[model samples]
Target: MSRNIYAFLAIILLLLQNCSGQKTDTKFYDKDFKWSIQIPKDFTKVSAKEWAEKQQKGENALEETTGEEVINEAKTIFVFKTDDMNYFEANYQPFDINIDGDYRENNRNVNHALYQTFRDNMPNARIDTLSSTEKIDSLFFYKYETKIYLPNNQILDIIMYSKLFDKKEFTVNIMFTDPKCGKEMIDAWKNSKFEK
Candidate 1:
């Protein structure tokens, strides 16, 4: 009986250790989006609604879209930053606009729609198309490098990488401030895969 108790205690300790272990990496997954990506420990993930509420109260503030846009399929927008500096916002928004025929044809139309949306969203930002279309595995991606001038007269370099799958579109907009962190963020975006 004493030996059994000791074995159980050891197992409990191991479990507790694992539970208390520092998270050096983090992953965010959404079934509706049918996508997943691994991010670093320093980046904090917050939903769009949660972020807006906190911002209204002046705490841990990050803004992606207006709170009005934070509805329905846009609800779970994930904001990531380090030390009060926002690096990017990642989210998947549903695209229910029907395409006529083939998957390839629909994909082309979807890509064009996504690109138009991006431009419409950031009318002032100067955009440079890094790669219009690139195929990886079963996914086609569109990338943009934009220079956005903030109100404070600061020019921010941003990367907008997007992909469409499972009737939804995924976007990762990363601020290219720190080269190392920027590379990691881009790699995370590229490494992201959707299963559906």
Candidate 2:
């Protein structure tokens, strides 16, 4: 009986440790945007040089594929990724000077239409968009969640948060191959704030 009790206690303790361990404390501040977020310990950010090189390579490939001049107006502030295949990226894009529409809905509307189009090509994927904007910090972000079911019984989930401010659109996206990581990120982001 005592052995069984000890085993149960050990399991309970382990669960408690895991729950407490998942709380994020490491904060990343973006001086340019005056934004801050607590990042999970499991994610690692690559060096700026590497990021720039990769960004250029990707843009080059995109330009080659489209046969058009590709201009990148977005500045990527950080890209955090985990070994478990979860990806988190943050960037801000300048709105075209001649862009028309409500400033608040411009970026969100474009992304909504674009993502809605993706549903037609992905028959096996389930996508969910929030009916209303959720305010995180100083911006009201349009939220989206996607789940892709694979043939081998695996799943990939994607979360997107976006908002427009002062003629610039800011976006944060997280692709989670691990549900636990997604939960952690969601929790961390819930506490996000604009310090300015």
Candidate 3:
């Protein structure tokens, strides 16, 4: 089959795997906290080890995709923790980045303006809002839902956000998307755990 079809099937299988078993103890690590959560049987546990293995195998099998491909396949959710401030800085910093067709060259100009607008609006406070963007991994990405008639009309939904409880400097990124299966994906992220 095609790569997109393979991705979609893998996602479905992962979801089913997550939903089939009893609640499992999930663990994740951050800079300051080693967290554990009881995950329901409906969300697949994409362990760091497994993710690494998949990457090594050259199999984009976890179902996370941006741009117009999401509409044809199931949406994917990814949860990973990074203690490296430099990585987060690179991700959040404003630069002349382009994804799909959305562009944010200036901190003041752009269509969605998430990075710029949020920083300007809440200089020192934790900020959260939902908006559309045409960028992910330096490529274009749609917002909560896919754009109409786009070749890959997939929408990435940010379900939850939590800063480091004690450190107050670290951030947790939890995002998921499934055309009509949003609730299932969100529940998985909500019940996720982290290990320090």
Candidate 4:
């Protein structure tokens, strides 16, 4: 199996595990990470510890990814999902982007690598080029949508928004088990504020 699929499955399972519901509008803030996002009153927000416990209690499908270690690093930002629990409204995480020489060129190379990896893993995968290069507030992002055909003919729509800042990258991921939430997810992504 491709490592990208393993990484992607790990992230999806991490999001789906040990999810609990919460009321009241809340602002998710991580002081050390210097990032915050507004989670609506109807949504639910939980801790990464809870998800870790859930993964440990289960069969751990992520571990079967052929030696791809699942690193549950107490993620500062947990997933924010809709009230119905059908889709993820918004998720934020910061990563150390390995941009070796030129930032833009390296970033493009990284994207290309991921694209090829995903295609290699899932031959039936349908990818759409939403925005190869989109700028927002002086930030350049490569955005795209992909439809992965799962077992039993179920399809998952994932819209990935990634930005390279200095040597770090911040990803704002929105997923829909049902494709109808695409517009709402895009709106939420646009309204989200990321403080560097």
**Index of the highest-TM-score prediction:** 2
Count of backbone clashes, every candidate in sequence: 0, 0, 18, 0
lDDT of 1: 0.47
Query: For candidate 1, which ten residues in a row score worst on lDDT?
Result: 1-10
- Across 1-196, the per-residue lDDT of candidate 1 in tens digits comes to 0001111111111211211122236787767656787887666554444444433321111112112221233333566654333365665555544642343444454344333433555466554444456554367766555555544554555565565556655656676445667777777777877784
TM-score of 4: 0.60
Residue 177 deviation, candidate 2, in Å?
1.7
Whole-model lDDT values for every prediction:
0.47, 0.56, 0.29, 0.50
TM-score of each: 0.54, 0.67, 0.30, 0.60
**All models, RMSD in angstroms:** 15.3, 13.9, 14.7, 5.3
Per-residue alpha-carbon lDDT of candidate 2 for residues 88-147, written as tens digits (9 for 90 to 100): 677777664355456545545444443443454345666555434777865678765656
lDDT of 1 at 98: 64
Best by lDDT: 2
Q: TM-score rank, highest first?
A: 2, 4, 1, 3
lDDT of 2: 0.56
